[model samples]
Target: MEALGWFLFAYQVFVLYYFAVLNFLYTTFTFFGLNMVARYARELSELSLKDLLEREAYLPVSILVPTYNEEKTIAASVRSFLALRYPEFEVIVVADGPKDRTLEVLKEAFALVEVDWVYRRALPTKPIRAVYRSLAHPNLLVVDKENGGKADALNAGLNFARYPLFCAVDADSLLDPEALLRASRLFLEDERVLAVGGTIRPLNGARVRGGVVEELRLPRGFLEKMQIIEYARAFFLGRAGWSAMDALLIISGAFGIFRREEALRVGGYRTDTVGEDMELVVRLHRKAREAGRDYRVLYTPDPICYTEVPSDWATLRRQRNRWHRGLWEVLLAHRAMLFNPRYGRLGFVALPYFLFFEALGPVVEVLGYALL
Candidate 1:
């Protein structure tokens, strides 16, 4: 009975220490993140942005929109991409064989005419049915292809993308007017940047007009309100902290830009994992490290993309479950890099943090609750 008492007491102490350390790290990250965000904000002035645009020294980007069954909002989403303030970019909308009238909607809305635009297939994807270009907007191109997942659709876009850089945007999301200019500026300023991740805010309560968010307001639903906080912590605190340390792992697939050549070199997006975005970023880090190349995967706060969050309980639960699964999927895939010195800080610091604090966090939390 005495030995049992000691075991119980030790378990309780372990749980306490676990939470204390987690909270402490969160606090530290908050400080680092706030400082980094402030520094970045000061660095990017309106005059500098105008000067950069005036000089025309920006790298052109191909914006890829992968759609599955987005018939309702496809038109608005594409319009927002076309309305971006960037100088040179093409919008590639891959219709990943949606069951609805997604193609018809695009054809009617944008006056899409089927074109036989020949392009090199750098990455293998499901066969493309036809390619269409918009009469209203010359820069818009749509690829109608077989039913493939989101990653497969992105790969198809990569196959036909012509620009030196590509920005992946979900079909349901909208980018701010200056989003492209700000994100692409990173690559232009730094030669070593392989990718740049931008901030994503929930569009649940925003007033959107002309495919742009005109007003930002608190969401009415409890789920959406909670999501706003979750996103703030994850991106503003977690991502910014990791980025300041040069160890950012997951870049949201909804809005991330990559150097096209580097993406192709790393074999594009992997279709096998639900966590394709995180996996692709991880692979990029692993490859760069192995090659002894100096590269930076960055996360910045200025550029923003607004995405529709789950409004209902069932949908919210499903989305969170999928995200959690994705986290574990990525951690397992790169298990070899957990503490190996070969990958340096990524292995030693970032991976371990994700493994111990993020991945195993829930399991430990549940155990802690039971013990308490």
Candidate 2:
């Protein structure tokens, strides 16, 4: 028993040291990335919005929203997307056989009328019941599909999407009016930029008017507050850091834009994993690199998407569990990239960091607590 205790103590010490080192590295990388983003934003903001609008430089985008039993927030969420400021875009809402009145509310609110839309199945998904286009909003389309997971719903949307650029957003998330504009700019400015991820802010305490977040304020709930801090650190530091290194791994599912052709060429979103967002991003990188193409997957700070974090402990834990599990799934799915030199920075740095810290860090911490 005494020997076992010592063993555990030693493990705890090692894990703590590992955690400290990882945090330090991340902090350093974050600082560097923040500086880069500051410089980039400054240069970008100098450009005339009128010039961008006039040139029609922005690519048309298809906003894919997947919802499951999200009746409470679905209407507001769709409205937010529809209100986004962009040159040309369409909103495809996928109702994943919600057990609630998700479809009913959508039909009634939008005055949806069934339409004959043709699409080729690029990725396998459950049977789609029907496709409806809103007479009220010409850009709004709804797909009634069997209960597929978020990934499947996204896949379904991809099939019906008719744009060069596609963005996947959660049904409960609210996008800032300029979110799409800022995110899509990367693709226009840099011909090589395949995807761009935007920052996700907590929507609980934010002031929303006309389906747009007018202002951002810290949420009153402790969980929401913690999440705000977490998101800030994750985006302002972690993701920005990775983006600077040209090795971003996970683009937030809440709001991310990708080239439709590239996403489809890579076989679209994986239905087997909950972390389909991360997996798809990784696959994009892999595919891009293998083709020896000078492609970039970037993270921009300005495009903000407000999403509701889990307010209760149970929901929070479940969400975290799902995220962790999804990370593990992606890691396993791309096990080839682990420590493989051919993938360059991604193989040496991002994959290892995620494996050690993001994937296994919790287990190490939990074990340390038990041991102590």
Candidate 3:
């Protein structure tokens, strides 16, 4: 028993040491990524707004919003999207068979009328009951589909999307009016860029008017405030670092833009995983590298999306559990790329970093606490 105790103690120490080193590396990567984003944003912003607008190169985008019992915030969210400043775009809201008045609220709010539209299955999904077009908002379409989780619902949205670029957002999230225009510009500017992810901020305490965030204020609640700091550290430091190295793995689902053909060719969103967003990104990198294609998956800081963070510990825990599980699922699904030479930086550095630090860091911390 004494020997076993010593073994456990040594194991805990080892895990703690590993955790520290991994965190240091993550911090390093984050610093680099953040600098890259800052420079990119500055350069992008320097371009005259008139020139950007008159570039004669607006790419049509389809915004896919997947909702499940989001009645409380659905109207505001949809209204926000409708007000986007893009020249051409469509919003597809997939009502994932909500038990509440979600569908009814949308129908009445948007003056939706059932429309006969043709869609082909790009990814396997639950049965879609009906598709509706809003007479009020000409570009808005809503689909009533069976509850098949967020991933499945997004796949359903992808099947019905008509644009060359598709963006997936949550029903409770609100995006900046120019977010899409800023993020999608990279795809147009660089033919090799495959996808672009934007920075996400917490929207808990922001003042809202006409479904747009009128002001940015720190939340009064401790939890919300902590998330605000967390988001700042994440986007300003973490994602920026990863983007610098071109090893960005997960783009926030709240606001990410992808080439429609590339997304479809890579099998769209995976239905079996809760971390479909991250999984799809990893697959994009894997496929691109495998095909010997020169491509870039980028993260930009200018396009901002604000999402509601859970205010309570219970809901927060549930969200974290789902996210951690999803990370594990994605890692397991692509275990083949772990240190595989062909994937270059992704295989050697990025994948291993996620496997060690992001995925296993919690377990290491827990064991350290147990030992103490």
Error of 1 at 229 (Å): 1.5
Q: What are the Cα lDDT values of the candidates?
A: 0.93, 0.89, 0.90
Instruction: Summarize candidate 3's per-residue lDDT along 1-372 as a digit string, tens digits.
Output: 899899997896787789688778867977797678668757776354447778767799999999999888899999999999888999999999999999999998999999888988877889989999999999999999999989889989999999999999999999999998889888888999999999999998889998999998888889999988888888877787888888989898888999999998999888889899999999999999999999998988889999999899999999999999999999999999999999999999899988888888788778768766
Local accuracy of candidate 1 as per-residue lDDT tens digits, 111-188 = 999999999898999999999999999999999999879999999999989999999999999999999999899999
- Models ranked on lDDT: 1, 3, 2
C-alpha RMSD (angstroms) for model 1:
1.2
Best by lDDT: 1
Better of 1 and 3 by lDDT: 1
List the candidate 1 regions with Cα displacement exceeding 4 Å.
1-4
- Per-model TM-score, in order, reads 0.97, 0.95, 0.95
Error of 1 at 107 (Å): 0.5
Tens-digit lDDT track of model 2 for 57-169: 78899999999998888998999899887889999999999999999999998999998888988878999999999999999999999997899999999999999999999
In angstroms, give how far residue 204 of model 1 lies from its true place: 0.9
To one decimal, what is the Cα RMSD in angstroms of model 3 from the true structure? 1.8
| Predicted structure with the largest TM-score when compared to the true one | 1
